[model samples]
Target chain A: GAGVSQSPSNKVTEKGKDVELRCDPISGHTALYWYRQSLGQGLEFLIYFQGNSAPDKSGLPSDRFSAERTGGSVSTLTIQRTQQEDSAVYLCASSANRGRVLHFGNGTRLTVT
Target chain B: AQRVTQPEKLLSVFKGAPVELKCNYSYSGSPELFWYVQYSRQRLQLLLRHISRESIKGFTADLNKGETSFHLKKPFAQEEDSAMYYCALSDTGANSKLTFGKGITLSVRP
Candidate 1:
């Protein structure tokens, strides 16, 4: 089975620019999640989506960070006005259902130059 | 609020030596604990979950609600066990959100 897929394995953006990272969860997966992995910071939860329920955006660092999972499948994480601190690997994961084991994608490495 | 803590940033052990990776968490309600591992150049994957009480790759973790801890242990560490390990907690049920720790790197030397 195809695992979770993320696009743009490497992305370099200028400060103040905006970048959108895409994620395609596995088929039949009802739960999708986004996380940021940085040196020393570890893996930080960014957002989560489960079926048709309202997504959890609590972990989003700022208003500039937002995500949308359209049609309950693909998700896009957009960071407006990117900053140096935003340089990190963005990971996407999907699970069969809530609280299930997650399958992760290769992730997109975003470097703010 | 939910938080997972891996106090040690790194752990290095010799082959055949016992290994223990400590993890502690704080949650208001019943928590679902999990251990995720990432080998070099590989994506993060589930190593084990507390609920299953199963061992994977000779590693086992016992969830101690009394101590609020879930520590991963192995009787004899192997070089292949070197990897990054993360302890996580699920915050919600229907819309479960995982809270991950800073993660700890385990290095097994021959």
Candidate 2:
């Protein structure tokens, strides 16, 4: 079976530009999450979506960061006015409803120059 | 707020030697602990969870509520075990969003 899939394996952009990272969760997985992986910073939770209810944006570092999951399957994390501080590997994960295990994608590495 | 801590950044050991990766966490309520591993060029994957109490790839972790620790251990190390390990915590609530620690790198030399 296919695991979580993320697009644009690597992206380099100039500061102040907007970037959108996409994620395709495995079929039937209802929960989707985005995380930022930085050197020495570990995996920082960005946002989470569970079913159709309100999304958990508590982990978003700032208002510049936002994400939306359409049809409860595909998700896109959008960063407005990217900053060098935002450079990191963005990871997407999914799990079944109430399932404890999280299947992760290879992640998209974003670098702001 | 819940927090996971992997105090050490790196550990190096020879093959066949015992390995222990330390992990400690802090949370207000009862939390679930998990160990995630990432091999070179591979995506992160679940290695084990405390609730399962099952060993995978010769690795096992025991959750100690009194100490707030869920350290991963292996009796004998293998060169193939070299990779990054992350400790994560999930609250018992419905959300189950995980809080991960700064991962530690294990280098198992042949």
Candidate 3:
């Protein structure tokens, strides 16, 4: 079976520019989540979507960060203005639902130069 | 708010020695604990969960509500087990959010 897939694998963006990261979850997985991994901070939950009911954006660091999942499968996370601090590995995961083990993608490393 | 902590940043063990990775969490309600492993150049995946009560890859974790810990343990470690491990806590009773620890890098020697 195909696992979660993320695009580009790596991205380099100039500071103050906007960037979009894409994620394609495994088929039949109802829940999708976005996470970021950085040195010292470990991994932080960014947002979560489950069958398009209503996205949980509580973990978004600021207003500049946003994500949308279309057709309940593919998701994209956008940063309006990138910063050096945002340079980290952006990971996406999917699961049958909450309380289940999440299957994660290899992640897209974004570097804000 | 729930938080997971892995105090040790790195741990080293011999190939035939026992290994224990510490994990602790603080949550208001009953929470579900999980251990996730990430081998080099591999995707992060679940190693085990408290509810399942099953061992995965020779690793096991016992949840202790009194100590507020769910440390992962293995009787004998292999060099392949060397990787970054994270402790996560899910507040299943309330809002569904997974809080993760900082993670610990384990190195196994032959």
Clash number for every model? 0, 0, 0
The better candidate by lDDT, 2 or 3, is 2
Deviating ranges (above 4 Å) for candidate 3 = none
lDDT of 1 by residue, A1-113 (tens): 88999999999999999999999999999989999999999999888888645468888999999888888899999999999999999999999978678999999999999
* Selected candidate, larger DockQ, 1 vs 3: 1
Question: For candidate 1, lDDT tens digit of each residue in B1-110?
Answer: 88899999999999999999999999989898999999999999999998899989999999899999999999999999999999999855667788899999999999
Clashes of 2: 0
The DockQ values of the predictions, listed in order, are 0.73, 0.73, 0.71
Share of true Cα-Cα contacts across chains kept by each model: 0.73, 0.68, 0.73
Model 2 per-residue lDDT tens digits across residues A1-113: 88899999999999999999999999999998899999999999988899655457899999999889889889999999999999999999998965378999999999999
- What order do you get sorting by lDDT, best first? 2, 1, 3
Colliding residue pairs in candidate 1: none
lDDT of 1 at B90: 85
For each candidate, what TM-score against the reference? 0.97, 0.98, 0.97
The digit string of per-residue lDDT tens for model 2 on B1-110 reads 98999999999999999999999999989898999999999999999999999999999999999999999999999999999999999998977799999999999998
**Candidate 2 has which clashing residue pairs, if any?**
none
TM-score of candidate 1 against the unseen true structure: 0.97
Question: In candidate 2, how many Å is residue A81 off?
Answer: 0.7
